[model samples]
Target: MDIIKGVPLTSYILLCSILFAIGALGVLYRRNALVIFMCIELMLNAVNLLMVAFSRYFNDSNAQVFVFFIMAVAAAEVSVGLAILMMVYRNTKTTDIDALSKLKY
Candidate 1:
């Protein structure tokens, strides 16, 4: 645990894990779809940070490739998710997913 080594890998990973956990909790507890989307983004960023840390420590290109793929998937997911969110907002006049209870069909 060299405190002078300019941020240890384990510390970076632990911080990322904590941030991801906070994002997960926010998604679980928030009613607004937009806020949940933001939390999901936070979690994605955390994963990206972890991947970057691993890549740096191991001098590996595979982790960087994986991070790029994750970014692509996240971009696609946000595009589709925002479309659905717009529909939800149009129908309910609110972005709160919990407020839309008519999806039982």
Candidate 2:
């Protein structure tokens, strides 16, 4: 806690912003579904980091609780998302986003 408090708020904000930007760019530019999914997780992690930083700075436990909820939800999402991705790959033989776009029967 002390280590986190030692760092300035601006530093955390800047780090989160950079992480979010990278995740956003990866989501937008990557063609593979897995890569896009990873980017989405990265974005979520950035938000979580910001939340935890603010909670630590403010000496509040609410944001920390919310972060746990977010992490649990993310875990469930990963299971479901990976199942869907596996099904898509099994059907289309490719994980390309463009390939999925052409999957209309």
Model 2 vs. true fold: TM: 0.92
lDDT scores in order: 0.91, 0.94
Best candidate (score: lDDT): 2
| Location of the lowest summed lDDT over 10 successive residues in candidate 2 | 1-10
For residues 1-105, write the lDDT of model 1, one tens digit per residue: 533467789998999999999999999999899999999999998999999889888889999999999999999999999999998888789997878888777
Model 2 root mean square deviation, Cα atoms: 1.9
TM-score for each candidate, following the candidate numbering:
0.89, 0.92
| Local error of candidate 2 at residue 76 (angstroms) | 0.6
**What lDDT tens digits, residue by residue, belong to model 2 across residues 6-105?**
6789999999999999999999999999999999999999999999999988899999999999999999999999999999889999999888665476
**Minimal lDDT window, size 10, model 1:** 1-10
Model 2 stretches with alpha carbons more than 4 Å out: 103-105
